[model samples]
Target: MLFLTRDLFSKKLTILFLIILGTYGCKTKTSSEQTAEQAPALVKSPEFNADSAYQFVQKQVDFGPRVPNTAPHKACGNYLVSTLKKYGFSVVEQTFKDTTFDGTIINGRNIIGSFNTANAKRILLTSHWDSRPFSDQDSLVKNKPVMGANDGASGVGILLEIARVLSLQATKPDIGVDIIFFDVEDWGATEQDTSMLHSGFCLGSQYWAANKHIPNYTAYFGVLLDMVGAKGATFLKEGYSMQMAEDVVREVWTTASRIGYNNYFIDERGGSITDDHVPVNTVAHIPMIDIIHTKNSVVRTFFDQWHTADDTMEHIDPKTLKAVGQTLVQVLYQESANLAL
Candidate 1:
């Protein structure tokens, strides 16, 4: 009877141990699930369609050189406005006038489009739409206008593609997006011209900075794209961008590195350029960065075909466009994820 009692006690102890172990395992699983639920999931953005972006670029080129005060320029501006409206954005055509370095009165139109207008948290994307009035950098066609396939149209094409993709989504980003196509960006004075006004370049940006489309309009940050579709392009960290918005530059560059575009976005420092971001940063009080392709070896700190008649589809690479556009989309979605957190 004593031996039977001993065996019975041992069995009871074994049963208790098994039950405790099972309860512990269940608690651990529940804890893990709770932790996962607390963490925000990665938001996946839409795939950037390089082919569509390329087609957009081609459409602008088909309008011929978009020099200010020209027929092609006006027609292209109208198309841009209509396209933004078609993509479900509230469009604003900010019309203004500015005098060029040569004292020529030019009609400038800063096309602004807004997505998710009610959201106070906003991101701004910008590009110059006007082509250079003359190909001063081309030895063969110094007097002819630049086609601006890469410099002017590439950035617009990418942004337009982004707009289209966002419009198709049932649930949009957590933040608002604003696209501004600045006019009269390439009508500055030539390098050899001595009668240059200090405010000769970036006239459209300057005007918009002073008189914004919306009163007291502000964004978390702004990014300006220039010459981003060149083949074998290398985008060094620009100087003015680093000085004005180092955190944004670091985040953007880190994003590029995280997504296999580090080859295009180099880690080196580039010279400061007097681009549209300057006025946006200083006058408008918005921290803006320039994602411009710069090479010290090239004249005017730009690509080989900059401000030249050769600035055409021949030099614009679809791979380069994909790299930039994909990186931007990833950044936007990632930002949305952060907002969720």
Candidate 2:
């Protein structure tokens, strides 16, 4: 009877050990599974359609040089307003007149659009729409107006496509977004013409900065796109942008690098430009940066076709457009992930 009791005790002890072991194994497996479930998923930005952007540019170029106060300019302005509305944005047409460098009064319109109206934290994007009146830099055809396919229309086209993608997204970004197509930016006085009023450039932005679409409007940051569609374009950081909004510029350049666009967005300092972002930064008090394609050195010639009649569709590369557009989309959408819940 003593021997039988010993065997029974041994069986009981073995069963208890097995139960404890099973419980521990199950707990370890559960802990690993829980950890995986808690891991954060990577954020995904919407795809930017380079073809659509290219087509939008073509449409604007088809309207001829959009010089302010001309028939083509008026028609293009109307189209921009309509397109923004169609993309589910609250469009605002800011109309104002400003004197050009040559002392000519020109009618200008700034087309502004907004997305995610409920969100108070906003980001501003901008580009010029009006073409230069004369291709003064062109050795041949100095009397003709600039086509502005890359200088003006390219930025607008990319923004329009971005707006379209935003509208079609399944999940809207948590931050408010605004796009402004500022006119009269290219009407600045030439360097040689010292007698002309140099401040006459970027008139549309100057007007909007003083009289914003919303009273006392503000954005967390603003990005200005200029000369972004040139073939083999290299977008070095502008000097003013780096000085005023270094963090923003770093964020953009890093994002571009992350997305295999390090070639287009070089990690170098570029010459400061008096683009529309200048008024937005100084007058509106927003930290604005210009993502412009400028020469590496102080020469800052901008591009081969800059201010020339050769600034046409032939100079635009779909790859260049995609690089800028994709990087922009990634930055904007990733910003959503950074917002407070």
Q: List the residue pairs that clash in candidate 2.
A: none
Return the TM-score for each candidate structure: 0.86, 0.86
The worst-scoring run of ten residues by lDDT in candidate 2 lies at: 32-41
Candidate 1 regions off by >4 Å?
A: 1-42, 192-199, 298-300
Total backbone collisions for each predicted model:
0, 0
